[model samples]
Target: MITAIVLIQTVADRLTEAAQEVADIDGVAEVYSCAGDVDLIAILRVTNHEDIADIVPGRINKVAGVLDTDTHIAFRSYSSQDTEATFSLGLE
Candidate 1:
């Protein structure tokens, strides 16, 4: 799967509404409202890179309150669980 991290900026007053709308999009796996340089962060997982183009510019950017977006495509994923599992492979 292709994973994309999207940093979103939305109209201040419409933050909640925009987040809900983005969360409802098909390719969006998760949406988080945060306090920082960006208002919301969306996690998108799809089967192909082409889907990122269609989902981000074609849909997300068109949402009513969305002001701007910066998207990053993930090359690799590392988590504590993954690391632990790798190190403990023979312990089980």
Candidate 2:
């Protein structure tokens, strides 16, 4: 699976609606309203790399109130859940 973290810039007054629309887009796994340079973050996952474009600019960017976006494709996932599971392997 190809995973991308899309930082979204939404119109100030339309954040809530923008996020909801983003969440409804296909290939979008999750959307977060956050505090930072960007207003929202969207987690996009798909089977093909090219699909990222289809999902991002093709769909996501067209949503109402979405002003701009920056996409970062994940090379690896090192979540705490995965780390904890790894450390617990031989402790049983």
Candidate 3:
């Protein structure tokens, strides 16, 4: 599995809508509106590396309010619990 955090910059007054659209995209696990340099944060998971290429520019970056995005792909995922539990519940 591949996981990534997509830092999204959106047009003014579009965070809520952009977050919703991001969550609706395939391979996106979660989307949150944030108060920071980036307007939104999104969690994405895919079966392969190629999926990121296909999903990001083709789907996410194409969303109406999305201005730009920076993606941080996770190289390692460490957890005490099962993988599913860790990912699903976001535990340490």
Candidate 4:
């Protein structure tokens, strides 16, 4: 599975609506309104990397309130690292 995070920038007053609309897209797994430079952050899990090229620019950027998007892919998960360390230590 390929996982990516889309940092979305929206029109000044449309963060909520834009987040909801992006969340409704097929490959989106989660969406949150973040308190940072970026307006909303969306988590997407797709079957392949090519799906990102097709879905993100094609559908997400086309949403009305969306101003711009920056996507980041996971190379290594911190949560997975933590889990592995804990399990390898043989702790309950």
Error of 1 at 5 (Å): 0.1
**Decoy 4 TM-score against native:** 0.84
Clashes of each: 0, 0, 0, 0
Instruction: List where candidate 2 sits over 4 angstroms from the true fold.
Output: 85-92
Model 2 — TM-score against the truth?
Answer: 0.88
Error in Å for residue 46 of model 2: 0.9
Residue-level lDDT of model 3, residues 37-61, one tens digit each, is 9999888999998999988899999
Can you give the TM-score per candidate against the true fold? 0.88, 0.88, 0.82, 0.84
RMSD of 4: 2.9
Q: List, residue by residue over 1-92, the lDDT tens digit for candidate 1.
A: 99999999999999999999999999999999999999999999999999999999999999999999999999998989878888885854
- Candidate 3 at 44: error in angstroms? 0.7
The segments of candidate 3 whose C-alpha lies over 4 angstroms from its true place after superposition are: 79-92
C-alpha RMSD for every candidate? 2.2, 2.2, 4.8, 2.9
Model 2, 50: alpha-carbon shift in Å? 1.2
lDDT of 4 by residue, 14-53 (tens): 8888888899999999999978899988899998999898
> Could you give candidate 2's per-residue lDDT for residues 1-92 as a string of tens digits?
99999999999999999999999998999999999799999999999999998999999899999999999999998999979887886755
Better model by lDDT: candidate 1 vs candidate 3: 1
